[model samples]
Target: MTLFRESFATQQSLPPWEARGVQSWCFLFPLSATAIQRYLDEYFNFAHPEPAPFRFSALAEAQFGCLTISYYPVIASTNKANMLRYGPQTTSWDHLSYNEMYVAAPVLCNRVTPDNLLVDRQIVWIQPVVMCDNSSVVFATREIVGIDTMHATINLRPGRAPGSLHVDTQFSGFKTFSPTTAEGPLPFLHLETGSPLPGGLPEAATREDKAFLEGLFGVIGGVDLVGGVRPTTTRLISLKQFRDAYDLRLATYQAIVASTATHTDVSDLRFFDPKEVDLDFMWSASAEQILSSFLQLGRPGDEKASAPHEGPGWDLVGRQVKIKVAFAYTNNAVYDQIETLHTFGAE
Candidate 1:
């Protein structure tokens, strides 16, 4: 076995992070494919063989409406030995739990094998924005794994109806586009889901629902018909890089990392009708500038002009875009691990 060096400060003791009883809510919506591609190409530093070992793209121009917003009620490292390794200080800090939310789009990562012979292709989620309430999680996920994670205030509470949830996340950003505005916690995204409809899958499927399910299963993979269940082992890809301390323009280290999270026990697998979903996004100059693609706000000078609304952003109601899928599940004994798929800079 190859032993690795320990991390510094808060995350030093916990090498491999694990969680228990992780409950998650997932909502899927349609997004412009061209916009997704443009975002990946410009921000993620993706290119053909030039970025070297790997190339990535959306699953299909038309079939890929795989924009997803996932919320985790709490994420904490539950390993007893890792917690108490260095005694009280390590135990106290390592056990902190936090709420997290991230927006991602499914894409295909086509990579050249280690032998430099054939190409290996796989489906992975390219996460553009990941926010959590805990600083430790922010540092570890960003510095250690290259997950471009940021700190945010995440609130999860029971909705007005039974067995429903409302989640809202805020991050520091310019409330309005002006020199007078100061950066502070502003609205980022909001989600309100009705009670989980009592069913496995909707029997009377609309064209929109069918398209949504097909796009979902494309990324989810593996369905057990006999058992009437769909199990998922999600693999996420991230471009981890560090800029030179002296010259910010130069990258000291850069690599493409692939991470895995598996649901060992999944329960309460239920769906939500389109009518039951209410999702909203507010324009925070800090977060939304990069997220406009996922939100389907067309580029500048486009005929679809921006309609002014209260505050800094325009209101995006769920029904206007026709939300495809809404569901929630509980998973116990979830595991997370990462591996470097390709390194482009520094030994």
Candidate 2:
């Protein structure tokens, strides 16, 4: 059974654009209000201009960096009620007052001093803000000429996490695209009692210890070793994962990593179960149709059509298409377990 489902009934349609051919395109252009003001002053020749200033408000200061704009074509629906209800000015999609639509600014700062250095200090700072939000209010301005088409440009910036988990979740959902699977029972490598593996540690004397050791081995073996030695003997396992095997789910993985980094006590950890979600869709057109659509959105007006090398995620659609399809899983839990054969009492 699916863990979650979207309520299509809640969706509202706005308008349709007119164009030619079977393809549609959309664009997202992210820019700060400061940049917009600069563009207006330099290119459009604004009559009045303010002198360059070093200090500005926190909001203004936050807008001085890079931003993100997302764009996607709107597929019109035949339902007239849906269209009129969500049309243009009356549409909730265009209303910026909605909390979910508002962009938030966040600032991160850190300071550190080296242990051995006589006088060494470091400080890190990050400020992210949302600049603008825009969308095309598609209206049936003219009759559909063969196939419908429209071009939209949305101004965006680093904003607060969109309250709607749909977008982020969709991105996360794609991570397991070609997940590794176990086709058969894995071989067991037993360590003789009192015998240590190559690392100088004796074979685990208890089942729990053996399991912990195996989990550590899995993580180390998965990575390439330098000079045939693992980077660190410290095994990094999620607190949630550890809890799943032992029934503790109140702890967090980040805390575990942090504690281990500082040599803090981590005697007890919480755990949870891994949740999985999947999505599948069938399009009428061949794969080429989808590829062409993505390419057009990715590099508008560019003739060269190339698939992005980056793994599937937000980076794939960076500063290009605003509209995208994605899915995600949350509250997933995993556990590290020991490998050992146990015999129950039998006649």
* Top of the candidates by TM-score: 1
Every model's TM-score: 0.80, 0.15
Give a tens-digit lDDT track for model 1, residues 258-291.
8876766676677777677776565545654655
- Across residues 229-316, which tens digit of lDDT does each residue of candidate 2 receive? 1222221111111123454752111111100111112121111111111111111112123223322222223333222222332232
Model 1: residue 17 alpha-carbon error in angstroms: 1.8
Residue 115 displacement (Å), model 1 = 12
Please count the clashing residue pairs in each candidate, in the order shown.
Answer: 0, 21
CA lDDT of every candidate = 0.64, 0.22
Stretches off by above 4 angstroms in model 1 are 1-8, 12-15, 43-50, 61-93, 113-118, 203-205, 224-231, 298-321
lDDT value, residue 243 of candidate 2: 23
Runs in model 2 lying further than 4 Å from the true structure: 1-37, 43-45, 48-60, 69-347
lDDT of 1 at 232: 58
Model 1 clash count equals 0
